[model samples]
Target: MQLPLIDLVVFFVYLLGIILFGVSFSFKGRTSNDFQTGGGRLPAWALGMSIFATYVSSISFLALPGNAYQSNWNVFVFGISIPIAAYMAVRYFVPLYRSLRSESAYFYLEERFGPWARTYASVCYLLTQLARMGAIMYLLALPMHALLGWDVGLIIVVTGVSVILYSMLGGIEAVVWTDAVQAVLLIAGAIACIVVIFVSMPEGPAQVFSIAMENQKFSLGSMDLDFTTSTFWMVLVYGLFINLQNFGVDQSYVQRYVSARTDAEAKKSTLLGSLLYIPVSFLFLFIGTALYSFYQANPENLPAELQLSGNADKVFPHFIASELPLGLTGLLIASVFAAGMSTVSTSINSSATLLLSDHYQRYINPQISEKQSLRFLRIASLTMGGLSVLVGLAFNGVSSALEAWWALSSIFSGGILGLFFLGLILNKTKKPNVIPAMIVGVLAIAWVSLSPVLFSEGSIFRSQLHTNMTIVVGTMTIFLLGFLFTWLVQKENGKPIKSSSD
Candidate 1:
């Protein structure tokens, strides 16, 4: 079904508004520092909102509800770990970065370990963000395809181009401010869906809850301790480790931290973003349960494709297209676009920041002029955006969007969290030993992350380990082996391992 004329107007107006709003910030920053970090003058709340928006991509918008609709609330175990990760970030990581006054999050790695460590971490970050941007774009295209009957490729290209243009022209300030807007729209959109679901039901909210409970949709998670399955323990552990990566090591959040006006503001932003995520995530999950109840109560309202495919992911989008009144559909669709644009813009800007700060500036042109650097930043932003589009196109036939994204993220995180753990926990570890430690860390993570894809179903590694355990195993392996290797090197040289300062 096509959107009504009014709905089309609303959607187009929203796209136009984003472009205009982003472009307004283009002339606001003149230098590379201003472009990359917003001259370190962004407000706390705005940064917090941007951080939240950046994390809540269209994948969460679509997949979370689908996840809840199909299964229990086990996946929300991931959000439970965010607070713990955010606390650690505010207490240690934020202060460390602010004190260093570095543009790149990986700069501290170079200081504590070596240049190679910084490069490796940055490369991992680039790969992770590319995968992230691609997944989000592809997910966004699904709803658009459903709504307009347009080609998914066309949708992806149009959305990708729009985001790249805005991000490339306006820089981080534009990205951050636009994200603040997108965040509000996304939350409002989710709330709107919930309200519609309740109102549309014959017996209302209580009926929805009763039905969900009867169906066991509210179950938090499984209590099994099995490592080979997605038990509560497995997801909880995975969530903790992955959240650590998000708060401690992800360039996206780290960039937000550095963009804050002060160290205290940065910490505040982290806490605020993390706290906000829990309720918002719950809202999305609730929408899923409510959706299940809503559709069950009125099977006639469900889409034919969803009915045929039994794919829960399409249910929400189908509802928006077939059920909601005209203008409201457009608004919700705009919100979906908002969710996607906020994340992709951040990815483009931050990836470019990493390329310029970590690589180009470090190696090719340490003393490049401001004009030249700004030019390069724009070029890099556009290039990354294009590459991400290609990546999105490449991932056309995934079995499950959310699961595939999580697996890709685990692979690319590369256990850099372990490297940070080493720097923070063992102050006396020698810098020179970090190279071998990182090598071992990468190899171990690769083994765990790739075993399922590379090995047969009956292979020992594939049969024994759950995918969620990859990060936990990879992180621990890196921290322990890195520390041990440092010790061994120190013993062989007959010298005490010196502190980072030494």
Candidate 2:
């Protein structure tokens, strides 16, 4: 299954070029302000593309198609929820971020809810990003394993080193610019994949449609008003909540807002990133459907194991390795790498930024010099990158990258997203009111996320609600409890209610 010589060259060239290219920015990142915010000089469109690339990580690049091929378009509804989430982010979150004096995403959390809230949110962010980096690393390795027969662990280490080095050298400037370029590569590669699939079918391109229709592959899942499964409504709720967390409170995104030249540009960047993904996501899903038809008509093309439901993730990579022409195969491989690089670089840089702004600079050394800060940022990025590599190795046999990420994300995201909403909705929710609500929210999240392992599978005490509801349930639980407590305290003290959301 190893790639031919030509394909190998293309892949290696991209890897080497990106590292050298990013390292060229070492001088730019030597200073504190330049490293973190790039003087707020980047144009809107490039920032938008970087945001989109962050959204469409390699996990999405590979797993979206796999999900479509395995069943139907049920997951596509997640994309459908983006605009809704983006609207709220642009309308509310963007301006809030633009007004920040520091690039730290959790600064406002501390200002509003005290150091406890900021620390909790930052810790959750770091964990979530680590899980995210791990998933993307694993997904990036999957194809290389199928194509080059390389050990997945080796590929992850090599890839992680490359991304981490670039983040160290380039800072925010390098991440944003490379992300813009890599985003284009991913989109273009996806289109190329769909085209090849359409042309490869013996029955011609129209067969893609007929085959999709026959299997109900275009379904958005059952439209039933159910929360016990990944029904259309449930996924929309999940997507909205997750997207809100990402666009609203996530550090990676908050850094982008701080880096943008203007508030309007930042808002537009969010809109463009969200809107652009709709069609791009469609392309990936369609590629999967077309792949289903391509392989269905040529059953012998796919191995018997890959035909199993659990092996869907392998199909797309297997196809890229075995089916595409020589140069094109290299390009698509580069695309997967591009997707991974764009996201990993962004996360490593942003995570380091958070570490510096929220913890090291704030606690350990408030007066550290730019040169010292630069050194610290690089060391932090390297440490986190290594941790992520270990996490990726831990996912040695997962059936679906997307599934694993969804669960891991819920555990960390619920607290911040819920707490953020509570602060926004009930301005009177003081730091004292938050401690109990957060305690309850954490317990609720832990119960929902770990119930299957904690309780017997058939136990009625286990959470029967779909896992997609983890964020939604945790968020509402915190918000509701916090609000009730706030109101109760206000009434008991005989204080006049003067809280306003804005």
Off by over 4 Å in 2: 397-404, 428-432
**After superposition, candidate 1 runs with Cα above 4 Å error:** 308-310, 398-404, 461-463, 493-502
Tell me the RMSD of model 2 versus the true structure. Answer: 1.7
Q: Provide the lDDT at 102 for model 2.
A: 81
lDDT of 2: 0.86
Model 1, 96: alpha-carbon shift in Å? 0.4
User: How accurate locally is residue 454 in candidate 2, as Cα lDDT from 0 to 100?
Assistant: 82
lDDT of 2 by residue, 173-195 (tens): 88888888898889989988988
Best by TM-score: 2
TM-score of predicted structure 2: 0.96
Candidate 1 lDDT over residue span 1-502, tens digit each: 7679999999899999998999888866468898889999999999999999988989889989998998889988888888889989998899988988878999988888889889988998899888888888888998889888889888889889999988999999999999999999999999999989989998877999999999999998779887778788888888888888888888889998999998899999999877899999999999999999998899888756686545888888888887787799999999999999999999999999999989999999999899999999999999999999998887778776656777788778857899888888766664746666667766777777677778987877653677778888878888888778887889898977665556
| Highest lDDT model number | 1
